[model samples]
Target: MPLLAGAATVVAVVGAVLALADVDSPLRGPFTLFFLLAAPSVAIAAALRGLDPFGRLLASVAGAITVDMLVAQGMLAVHRWSVRGGIAAVTALSSVLLLLVVVRRLRGRTASRRTS
Candidate 1:
């Protein structure tokens, strides 16, 4: 989760710098940061705290889509490249991280059970 947050922060900072410099960019700082952090953060929180897996997945996907839309709008405003690529990259990476966490937890559980 911290790793995801850090990555999101970096992306947000980059986006913000680009925005301030009037460079073509897909998203604003705040929105990019929020979405980048929020999706994985929420997913990890939900999973670790006993939220349903389906629910977590749904929330993450929705969050990602919302961020993608916002980024697309930002890019459109600046007449930059389409936001699709960045959005896809972020979403894919986040999903992979989320899956990894879940898998690791599950493996730990199975291992402990076997030991017991």
Candidate 2:
């Protein structure tokens, strides 16, 4: 998971830098999607492997959503919103959902153990 997170971070940084440098490139769209989407998913996945799962999940979700919203609003303000923005939002939300599932599973296991 840590390896995945590191890879995702590197990808996100590269994408973000590329997008910042050339906003009109065809590749920018996909890279932006990757940066905006995969980074948080990686963070959440890594967090699930540690303690304080709920806190980490919430922090990841909040940070991801904040970043996504800021980028979306910035693009919208500049009248540059596009399908890529939608893709980013969906991807981030999906990642958050995945994290929620992991958290729920962990909670269930703990509860079952306590009851047993």
Per-candidate RMSD, Å: 11.7, 9.9
What digit string (tens of lDDT, one per residue) describes model 2 on residues 21-75? Answer: 6567777777776777566655555655564867777777676677677767877
C-alpha lDDT score of every prediction, in listed order: 0.63, 0.69
Worst 10 residues of 2 by lDDT: 83-92
TM-score, one value per model: 0.39, 0.39
Stretches of model 1 off by over 4 angstroms after superposition: 1-33, 40-81
Task: Quantify how close model 1 is to the true structure by its C-alpha RMSD in Å.
Answer: 11.7
Q: In terms of TM-score, how similar is model 2 to the real structure?
A: 0.39
